[model samples]
Target: MPNLTITEMNNLKEELKKKGYKLTPQRRAIVDTIIENEGKHLTVEEIYDEVKKDCPEIGLATVYRTILLLEELQIVYKLDLNDGCSRYEMVHKDEIHRHHHLICTKCGSVIEVEGDLLENLEVKIEKQYNFKIKDHSVKFFGICQNCGE
Candidate 1:
Protein backbone atom coordinates (compact mmCIF):
# COMPACT_ATOMS: atom_id res chain seq x y z
CA MET A 1 0.00 0.00 0.00
CA PRO A 2 1.36 3.38 -1.00
CA ASN A 3 0.66 6.30 1.27
CA LEU A 4 -1.01 9.13 -0.59
CA THR A 5 0.33 12.55 0.27
CA ILE A 6 -2.03 15.32 1.33
CA THR A 7 -1.31 17.13 -1.92
CA GLU A 8 -2.30 14.08 -3.92
CA MET A 9 -5.57 13.81 -2.06
CA ASN A 10 -6.22 17.52 -2.59
CA ASN A 11 -5.51 17.20 -6.28
CA LEU A 12 -7.94 14.28 -6.55
CA LYS A 13 -10.55 16.31 -4.73
CA GLU A 14 -10.01 19.20 -7.12
CA GLU A 15 -10.39 16.86 -10.05
CA LEU A 16 -13.69 15.59 -8.69
CA LYS A 17 -14.88 19.15 -8.23
CA LYS A 18 -13.93 20.02 -11.78
CA LYS A 19 -16.15 17.19 -12.93
CA GLY A 20 -19.06 18.36 -10.78
CA TYR A 21 -18.72 15.51 -8.29
CA LYS A 22 -18.25 15.85 -4.56
CA LEU A 23 -15.79 13.73 -2.66
CA THR A 24 -18.39 12.19 -0.43
CA PRO A 25 -17.53 9.94 2.50
CA GLN A 26 -18.34 6.78 0.56
CA ARG A 27 -16.26 7.90 -2.35
CA ARG A 28 -13.41 8.82 -0.03
CA ALA A 29 -13.49 5.40 1.55
CA ILE A 30 -13.34 3.76 -1.86
CA VAL A 31 -10.38 5.88 -2.93
CA ASP A 32 -8.55 5.27 0.35
CA THR A 33 -9.03 1.52 0.01
CA ILE A 34 -7.68 1.61 -3.52
CA ILE A 35 -4.61 3.56 -2.41
CA GLU A 36 -4.03 1.34 0.60
CA ASN A 37 -4.16 -1.74 -1.58
CA GLU A 38 -2.00 -0.50 -4.38
CA GLY A 39 -0.66 -3.18 -6.74
CA LYS A 40 -3.28 -5.62 -5.55
CA HIS A 41 -5.45 -5.07 -8.69
CA LEU A 42 -8.61 -5.50 -6.77
CA THR A 43 -11.99 -6.30 -8.27
CA VAL A 44 -15.21 -4.44 -7.40
CA GLU A 45 -16.33 -7.11 -4.94
CA GLU A 46 -12.94 -7.12 -3.28
CA ILE A 47 -13.00 -3.35 -2.97
CA TYR A 48 -16.48 -3.44 -1.53
CA ASP A 49 -15.43 -6.02 1.04
CA GLU A 50 -12.51 -3.91 2.21
CA VAL A 51 -14.45 -0.66 2.31
CA LYS A 52 -17.35 -2.24 4.23
CA LYS A 53 -15.01 -2.68 7.21
CA ASP A 54 -14.73 1.06 7.89
CA CYS A 55 -17.96 2.09 6.18
CA PRO A 56 -20.50 -0.41 7.32
CA GLU A 57 -23.31 1.35 5.50
CA ILE A 58 -21.53 1.45 2.19
CA GLY A 59 -23.21 -0.50 -0.58
CA LEU A 60 -21.65 -2.59 -3.31
CA ALA A 61 -23.44 -0.44 -5.88
CA THR A 62 -21.82 2.64 -4.39
CA VAL A 63 -18.40 1.06 -4.65
CA TYR A 64 -19.01 0.07 -8.27
CA ARG A 65 -20.25 3.55 -9.14
CA THR A 66 -17.30 5.22 -7.45
CA ILE A 67 -14.87 3.01 -9.33
CA LEU A 68 -16.53 3.86 -12.63
CA LEU A 69 -16.43 7.57 -11.81
CA LEU A 70 -12.76 7.37 -10.85
CA GLU A 71 -12.02 5.52 -14.05
CA GLU A 72 -13.78 8.20 -16.05
CA LEU A 73 -11.67 10.80 -14.23
CA GLN A 74 -8.49 8.87 -15.13
CA ILE A 75 -7.70 8.43 -11.45
CA VAL A 76 -7.83 4.67 -11.94
CA TYR A 77 -8.01 2.20 -14.81
CA LYS A 78 -9.44 -1.28 -15.25
CA LEU A 79 -7.07 -4.17 -15.71
CA ASP A 80 -8.27 -7.37 -17.37
CA LEU A 81 -6.01 -10.32 -16.74
CA ASN A 82 -8.20 -12.69 -18.84
CA ASP A 83 -9.16 -14.57 -15.71
CA GLY A 84 -12.87 -13.71 -16.00
CA CYS A 85 -12.50 -10.84 -13.56
CA SER A 86 -11.98 -7.12 -14.05
CA ARG A 87 -9.44 -5.68 -11.65
CA TYR A 88 -8.27 -2.11 -11.22
CA GLU A 89 -5.20 -0.10 -10.24
CA MET A 90 -4.51 3.57 -9.69
CA VAL A 91 -3.14 5.72 -12.48
CA HIS A 92 0.21 7.30 -11.70
CA LYS A 93 0.45 10.86 -12.97
CA ASP A 94 4.15 10.46 -13.69
CA GLU A 95 3.68 7.52 -16.03
CA ILE A 96 3.35 8.43 -19.70
CA HIS A 97 2.32 4.86 -20.48
CA ARG A 98 0.96 2.03 -18.38
CA HIS A 99 3.54 -0.36 -17.04
CA HIS A 100 3.64 -4.02 -18.04
CA HIS A 101 2.63 -6.94 -15.87
CA LEU A 102 4.10 -10.40 -15.38
CA ILE A 103 1.43 -12.96 -14.57
CA CYS A 104 2.22 -16.29 -13.07
CA THR A 105 0.04 -18.86 -14.76
CA LYS A 106 0.31 -21.52 -12.10
CA CYS A 107 -0.02 -19.45 -8.90
CA GLY A 108 -2.14 -16.63 -10.32
CA SER A 109 0.13 -13.83 -9.13
CA VAL A 110 0.84 -10.54 -10.84
CA ILE A 111 4.17 -8.73 -10.81
CA GLU A 112 4.48 -5.23 -12.16
CA VAL A 113 7.39 -4.54 -14.47
CA GLU A 114 8.88 -1.08 -14.04
CA GLY A 115 9.70 1.32 -16.92
CA ASP A 116 8.59 1.42 -20.54
CA LEU A 117 9.98 -1.61 -22.36
CA LEU A 118 8.53 -0.75 -25.77
CA GLU A 119 9.83 2.72 -26.52
CA ASN A 120 11.96 1.59 -29.41
CA LEU A 121 9.22 -0.56 -30.86
CA GLU A 122 6.76 2.27 -30.53
CA VAL A 123 9.11 4.64 -32.30
CA LYS A 124 9.68 2.16 -35.09
CA ILE A 125 5.97 1.48 -35.57
CA GLU A 126 5.21 5.18 -35.49
CA LYS A 127 7.77 5.86 -38.18
CA GLN A 128 6.92 2.89 -40.32
CA TYR A 129 3.18 3.40 -40.31
CA ASN A 130 3.14 7.17 -39.74
CA PHE A 131 0.92 6.69 -36.73
CA LYS A 132 0.90 8.46 -33.39
CA ILE A 133 1.22 6.34 -30.28
CA LYS A 134 -0.58 7.28 -27.10
CA ASP A 135 -0.64 4.37 -24.67
CA HIS A 136 -0.48 0.59 -24.46
CA SER A 137 -0.80 -2.33 -22.04
CA VAL A 138 1.39 -5.42 -22.08
CA LYS A 139 1.08 -8.62 -20.09
CA PHE A 140 3.50 -11.52 -20.05
CA PHE A 141 2.17 -14.84 -18.84
CA GLY A 142 4.47 -17.58 -17.63
CA ILE A 143 5.40 -19.73 -14.65
CA CYS A 144 6.91 -17.67 -11.86
CA GLN A 145 9.98 -18.75 -9.92
CA ASN A 146 7.96 -20.02 -6.99
CA CYS A 147 5.68 -22.02 -9.24
CA GLY A 148 8.64 -23.46 -11.17
CA GLU A 149 10.46 -24.39 -8.00
Candidate 2:
Protein backbone atom coordinates (compact mmCIF):
# COMPACT_ATOMS: atom_id res chain seq x y z
CA MET A 1 0.00 0.00 0.00
CA PRO A 2 1.14 3.55 -0.65
CA ASN A 3 2.21 5.65 2.28
CA LEU A 4 -0.65 7.46 3.97
CA THR A 5 -0.59 11.24 3.62
CA ILE A 6 -1.16 13.64 6.52
CA THR A 7 -4.36 14.91 4.96
CA GLU A 8 -5.75 11.42 4.59
CA MET A 9 -4.91 10.60 8.19
CA ASN A 10 -6.54 13.78 9.43
CA ASN A 11 -9.56 13.20 7.23
CA LEU A 12 -10.00 9.72 8.69
CA LYS A 13 -9.85 11.07 12.22
CA GLU A 14 -12.28 13.84 11.40
CA GLU A 15 -14.66 11.44 9.75
CA LEU A 16 -14.63 9.20 12.82
CA LYS A 17 -15.29 12.18 15.04
CA LYS A 18 -18.14 13.32 12.84
CA LYS A 19 -19.69 9.89 13.31
CA GLY A 20 -19.46 10.24 17.11
CA TYR A 21 -16.57 7.83 17.37
CA LYS A 22 -13.24 8.27 19.13
CA LEU A 23 -9.88 7.09 17.91
CA THR A 24 -9.18 4.81 20.80
CA PRO A 25 -5.98 2.83 21.19
CA GLN A 26 -7.73 -0.44 20.37
CA ARG A 27 -9.23 0.97 17.22
CA ARG A 28 -5.89 2.45 16.18
CA ALA A 29 -4.16 -0.87 16.70
CA ILE A 30 -6.75 -2.70 14.63
CA VAL A 31 -6.46 -0.19 11.77
CA ASP A 32 -2.69 -0.38 11.92
CA THR A 33 -2.82 -4.16 11.60
CA ILE A 34 -4.99 -3.91 8.48
CA ILE A 35 -2.86 -1.18 6.87
CA GLU A 36 0.44 -2.79 7.65
CA ASN A 37 -0.68 -6.11 6.24
CA GLU A 38 -2.55 -4.53 3.30
CA GLY A 39 -3.24 -7.51 1.00
CA LYS A 40 -2.99 -10.31 3.52
CA HIS A 41 -6.83 -10.64 3.71
CA LEU A 42 -6.78 -11.36 7.40
CA THR A 43 -9.74 -12.92 9.20
CA VAL A 44 -11.25 -11.71 12.49
CA GLU A 45 -9.56 -14.42 14.54
CA GLU A 46 -6.23 -13.60 12.92
CA ILE A 47 -6.71 -9.92 13.68
CA TYR A 48 -7.74 -10.61 17.26
CA ASP A 49 -4.70 -12.81 17.84
CA GLU A 50 -2.37 -10.14 16.50
CA VAL A 51 -3.99 -7.34 18.49
CA LYS A 52 -4.06 -9.39 21.68
CA LYS A 53 -0.27 -9.61 21.64
CA ASP A 54 -0.14 -5.86 22.24
CA CYS A 55 -3.44 -5.30 24.02
CA PRO A 56 -4.02 -8.30 26.20
CA GLU A 57 -7.22 -6.92 27.62
CA ILE A 58 -8.83 -6.82 24.19
CA GLY A 59 -11.49 -9.48 23.65
CA LEU A 60 -12.46 -11.43 20.56
CA ALA A 61 -15.90 -9.82 20.58
CA THR A 62 -14.31 -6.37 20.69
CA VAL A 63 -12.19 -7.16 17.66
CA TYR A 64 -15.24 -8.41 15.76
CA ARG A 65 -17.17 -5.25 16.62
CA THR A 66 -14.26 -3.03 15.60
CA ILE A 67 -13.91 -4.82 12.26
CA LEU A 68 -17.65 -4.51 11.57
CA LEU A 69 -17.56 -0.80 12.44
CA LEU A 70 -14.54 -0.24 10.22
CA GLU A 71 -16.28 -2.02 7.37
CA GLU A 72 -19.38 0.14 7.88
CA LEU A 73 -17.23 3.29 7.73
CA GLN A 74 -15.50 2.11 4.51
CA ILE A 75 -12.11 2.18 6.20
CA VAL A 76 -11.63 -1.47 5.26
CA TYR A 77 -13.04 -3.72 2.56
CA LYS A 78 -14.50 -7.05 3.54
CA LEU A 79 -13.59 -9.88 1.21
CA ASP A 80 -15.26 -13.24 0.67
CA LEU A 81 -12.94 -15.53 -1.29
CA ASN A 82 -15.27 -18.56 -0.88
CA ASP A 83 -12.92 -19.77 1.83
CA GLY A 84 -15.68 -20.02 4.44
CA CYS A 85 -14.34 -17.01 6.32
CA SER A 86 -14.55 -13.26 5.85
CA ARG A 87 -11.27 -11.43 5.37
CA TYR A 88 -10.44 -7.72 5.27
CA GLU A 89 -7.88 -5.29 3.93
CA MET A 90 -7.29 -1.56 4.21
CA VAL A 91 -8.85 0.76 1.63
CA HIS A 92 -6.39 2.54 -0.61
CA LYS A 93 -7.56 6.12 -0.86
CA ASP A 94 -6.02 6.93 -4.27
CA GLU A 95 -6.29 3.65 -6.13
CA ILE A 96 -8.94 2.14 -8.37
CA HIS A 97 -12.39 1.70 -6.78
CA ARG A 98 -11.63 -1.98 -6.26
CA HIS A 99 -8.93 -4.65 -6.63
CA HIS A 100 -9.08 -8.17 -8.02
CA HIS A 101 -7.99 -11.35 -6.32
CA LEU A 102 -6.17 -14.51 -7.41
CA ILE A 103 -7.18 -17.40 -5.20
CA CYS A 104 -4.98 -20.48 -5.02
CA THR A 105 -7.28 -23.44 -4.70
CA LYS A 106 -4.50 -25.77 -3.62
CA CYS A 107 -3.19 -23.76 -0.68
CA GLY A 108 -5.97 -21.25 -0.23
CA SER A 109 -3.59 -18.33 -0.77
CA VAL A 110 -4.90 -15.03 -2.09
CA ILE A 111 -2.86 -12.77 -4.34
CA GLU A 112 -4.07 -9.27 -5.09
CA VAL A 113 -4.03 -8.08 -8.68
CA GLU A 114 -3.83 -4.31 -9.04
CA GLY A 115 -5.39 -2.22 -11.82
CA ASP A 116 -8.95 -1.89 -13.09
CA LEU A 117 -9.13 -4.58 -15.75
CA LEU A 118 -12.84 -4.10 -16.40
CA GLU A 119 -13.16 -0.44 -17.39
CA ASN A 120 -13.84 -1.11 -21.05
CA LEU A 121 -15.92 -4.14 -20.22
CA GLU A 122 -18.02 -2.12 -17.82
CA VAL A 123 -18.63 0.55 -20.44
CA LYS A 124 -19.65 -2.06 -22.97
CA ILE A 125 -21.99 -3.73 -20.51
CA GLU A 126 -23.52 -0.43 -19.50
CA LYS A 127 -24.19 0.57 -23.11
CA GLN A 128 -25.47 -2.81 -24.20
CA TYR A 129 -27.61 -3.60 -21.16
CA ASN A 130 -28.37 -0.05 -19.99
CA PHE A 131 -26.94 -0.90 -16.62
CA LYS A 132 -24.85 1.32 -14.39
CA ILE A 133 -22.13 -0.60 -12.62
CA LYS A 134 -21.51 0.99 -9.26
CA ASP A 135 -18.97 -1.50 -7.88
CA HIS A 136 -17.43 -4.80 -8.97
CA SER A 137 -15.22 -7.59 -7.64
CA VAL A 138 -13.51 -10.51 -9.36
CA LYS A 139 -11.67 -13.58 -8.17
CA PHE A 140 -9.77 -16.12 -10.22
CA PHE A 141 -9.25 -19.53 -8.67
CA GLY A 142 -6.28 -21.66 -9.63
CA ILE A 143 -3.29 -23.46 -8.27
CA CYS A 144 -0.38 -21.25 -7.30
CA GLN A 145 3.05 -21.84 -8.86
CA ASN A 146 4.28 -23.39 -5.66
CA CYS A 147 1.38 -25.79 -5.50
CA GLY A 148 1.28 -26.52 -9.23
CA GLU A 149 4.60 -28.33 -9.14
Candidate 3:
Protein backbone atom coordinates (compact mmCIF):
# COMPACT_ATOMS: atom_id res chain seq x y z
CA MET A 1 0.00 0.00 0.00
CA PRO A 2 1.18 3.56 -0.70
CA ASN A 3 1.41 5.28 2.66
CA LEU A 4 3.12 8.50 3.68
CA THR A 5 5.06 9.15 6.83
CA ILE A 6 5.34 12.47 8.64
CA THR A 7 8.50 13.20 6.70
CA GLU A 8 6.78 12.43 3.46
CA MET A 9 3.95 14.66 4.53
CA ASN A 10 6.35 17.48 5.22
CA ASN A 11 8.07 16.93 1.90
CA LEU A 12 4.75 17.02 0.10
CA LYS A 13 3.92 20.27 1.79
CA GLU A 14 7.22 21.71 0.67
CA GLU A 15 6.55 20.54 -2.86
CA LEU A 16 3.14 22.13 -2.86
CA LYS A 17 4.69 25.30 -1.53
CA LYS A 18 7.02 25.30 -4.48
CA LYS A 19 3.92 25.06 -6.63
CA GLY A 20 2.63 28.19 -4.82
CA TYR A 21 0.16 26.41 -2.56
CA LYS A 22 0.40 26.82 1.16
CA LEU A 23 -0.40 23.52 2.83
CA THR A 24 -3.14 23.95 5.37
CA PRO A 25 -3.76 21.37 8.09
CA GLN A 26 -6.95 20.18 6.42
CA ARG A 27 -5.19 19.79 3.11
CA ARG A 28 -2.35 17.88 4.76
CA ALA A 29 -4.74 15.53 6.51
CA ILE A 30 -6.68 14.85 3.33
CA VAL A 31 -3.51 14.27 1.36
CA ASP A 32 -2.17 11.94 4.03
CA THR A 33 -5.42 10.01 4.10
CA ILE A 34 -5.32 9.69 0.34
CA ILE A 35 -1.79 8.28 0.44
CA GLU A 36 -2.64 5.84 3.22
CA ASN A 37 -5.72 4.66 1.39
CA GLU A 38 -3.99 4.70 -1.98
CA GLY A 39 -5.78 2.85 -4.78
CA LYS A 40 -9.14 3.49 -3.18
CA HIS A 41 -11.18 6.13 -5.03
CA LEU A 42 -12.69 7.80 -2.01
CA THR A 43 -15.72 10.03 -2.05
CA VAL A 44 -15.58 13.32 -0.13
CA GLU A 45 -17.56 11.82 2.75
CA GLU A 46 -15.14 8.95 3.04
CA ILE A 47 -12.26 11.39 2.94
CA TYR A 48 -13.95 13.50 5.59
CA ASP A 49 -14.20 10.41 7.82
CA GLU A 50 -10.49 9.75 7.55
CA VAL A 51 -9.45 13.39 7.81
CA LYS A 52 -11.60 14.10 10.85
CA LYS A 53 -9.45 11.72 12.88
CA ASP A 54 -6.58 14.19 12.60
CA CYS A 55 -8.59 17.33 12.11
CA PRO A 56 -11.72 16.75 14.12
CA GLU A 57 -12.93 20.29 13.61
CA ILE A 58 -12.73 20.22 9.86
CA GLY A 59 -15.98 20.23 7.90
CA LEU A 60 -17.17 18.46 4.77
CA ALA A 61 -17.12 21.74 2.87
CA THR A 62 -13.46 22.06 3.70
CA VAL A 63 -12.88 18.51 2.51
CA TYR A 64 -14.57 19.37 -0.75
CA ARG A 65 -12.51 22.53 -1.11
CA THR A 66 -9.21 20.82 -0.39
CA ILE A 67 -9.94 18.05 -2.88
CA LEU A 68 -10.85 20.54 -5.56
CA LEU A 69 -7.63 22.42 -4.95
CA LEU A 70 -5.66 19.20 -5.10
CA GLU A 71 -7.32 18.24 -8.35
CA GLU A 72 -6.37 21.59 -9.84
CA LEU A 73 -2.81 20.99 -8.73
CA GLN A 74 -2.81 17.59 -10.40
CA ILE A 75 -2.29 16.18 -6.95
CA VAL A 76 -5.72 14.54 -6.99
CA TYR A 77 -7.99 13.22 -9.74
CA LYS A 78 -11.72 12.61 -9.91
CA LEU A 79 -13.79 9.96 -11.66
CA ASP A 80 -17.24 11.18 -12.62
CA LEU A 81 -19.05 8.41 -14.48
CA ASN A 82 -22.39 10.08 -15.22
CA ASP A 83 -23.10 9.19 -11.59
CA GLY A 84 -23.84 11.67 -8.86
CA CYS A 85 -20.95 10.53 -6.73
CA SER A 86 -17.40 11.41 -7.78
CA ARG A 87 -14.40 9.42 -6.57
CA TYR A 88 -10.89 10.78 -6.12
CA GLU A 89 -7.35 9.44 -6.35
CA MET A 90 -4.09 10.97 -5.21
CA VAL A 91 -1.43 11.58 -7.82
CA HIS A 92 1.58 9.65 -6.55
CA LYS A 93 4.46 10.60 -8.77
CA ASP A 94 6.68 7.75 -7.66
CA GLU A 95 4.28 4.84 -7.59
CA ILE A 96 3.64 2.10 -10.10
CA HIS A 97 -0.12 2.05 -9.50
CA ARG A 98 -2.05 4.94 -11.02
CA HIS A 99 -5.38 6.71 -11.41
CA HIS A 100 -7.57 4.30 -13.37
CA HIS A 101 -10.42 2.80 -11.38
CA LEU A 102 -12.24 -0.52 -11.45
CA ILE A 103 -15.44 0.08 -9.56
CA CYS A 104 -17.70 -2.61 -8.18
CA THR A 105 -21.24 -1.59 -9.06
CA LYS A 106 -22.97 -3.51 -6.31
CA CYS A 107 -20.68 -2.76 -3.39
CA GLY A 108 -19.16 0.48 -4.71
CA SER A 109 -15.71 -0.86 -4.01
CA VAL A 110 -12.77 0.51 -6.06
CA ILE A 111 -9.60 -1.06 -7.40
CA GLU A 112 -6.58 0.67 -8.96
CA VAL A 113 -4.75 -0.38 -12.10
CA GLU A 114 -1.36 0.65 -13.46
CA GLY A 115 -1.59 3.53 -15.99
CA ASP A 116 0.67 2.37 -18.80
CA LEU A 117 -2.23 0.43 -20.26
CA LEU A 118 -4.20 3.63 -20.77
CA GLU A 119 -1.19 5.33 -22.32
CA ASN A 120 -1.28 2.73 -25.07
CA LEU A 121 -4.96 3.40 -25.63
CA GLU A 122 -4.30 7.13 -25.79
CA VAL A 123 -1.73 6.55 -28.51
CA LYS A 124 -4.21 4.50 -30.48
CA ILE A 125 -6.99 7.05 -30.06
CA GLU A 126 -4.75 9.89 -31.14
CA LYS A 127 -3.64 7.91 -34.18
CA GLN A 128 -7.17 7.09 -35.28
CA TYR A 129 -8.95 10.30 -34.28
CA ASN A 130 -6.11 12.82 -34.71
CA PHE A 131 -7.25 14.47 -31.55
CA LYS A 132 -4.31 15.41 -29.38
CA ILE A 133 -5.03 13.89 -26.04
CA LYS A 134 -3.89 16.20 -23.28
CA ASP A 135 -4.79 13.80 -20.47
CA HIS A 136 -7.16 10.89 -19.98
CA SER A 137 -8.91 8.70 -17.45
CA VAL A 138 -10.49 5.26 -17.53
CA LYS A 139 -13.01 3.52 -15.33
CA PHE A 140 -14.50 0.03 -15.43
CA PHE A 141 -17.71 -0.60 -13.56
CA GLY A 142 -19.39 -3.96 -13.08
CA ILE A 143 -20.77 -6.19 -10.38
CA CYS A 144 -17.92 -7.32 -8.18
CA GLN A 145 -17.31 -10.98 -7.41
CA ASN A 146 -19.35 -10.67 -4.25
CA CYS A 147 -22.34 -9.55 -6.26
CA GLY A 148 -21.60 -11.13 -9.61
CA GLU A 149 -24.50 -13.56 -10.11
Q: Provide the global lDDT of candidate 2 against the true structure.
A: 0.85
Candidate 2, residue 22: CA error in Å? 0.9
Against the true structure, what is each candidate's TM-score?
0.95, 0.91, 0.75
lDDT of 2 at 74: 85
- By the TM-score metric, which is better: model 2 or model 3? 2
Off by over 4 Å in 3: 1-11, 81-83, 94-98
User: lDDT per residue, candidate 2, 1-149, as tens digits?
Assistant: 23356886787788789888887888888887777777789999999888888899999998999898888888888899998999998877776667999999899988888799999999999999999898898999999998985
Tens-digit lDDT string for candidate 3 (35-96) = 78766667899999988987899999999988888888778878785468888877766744
What tens-digit string does per-residue lDDT give for candidate 1 at 92-112? 999999999999989999999
Order the candidate numbers by TM-score, best to worst. Answer: 1, 2, 3
Clashes per candidate (backbone, < 3 Å): 0, 0, 0
How does residue 1 of candidate 1 score in lDDT?
Answer: 30
| Top-TM-score candidate index | 1
Model 2 CA lDDT for position 147: 96
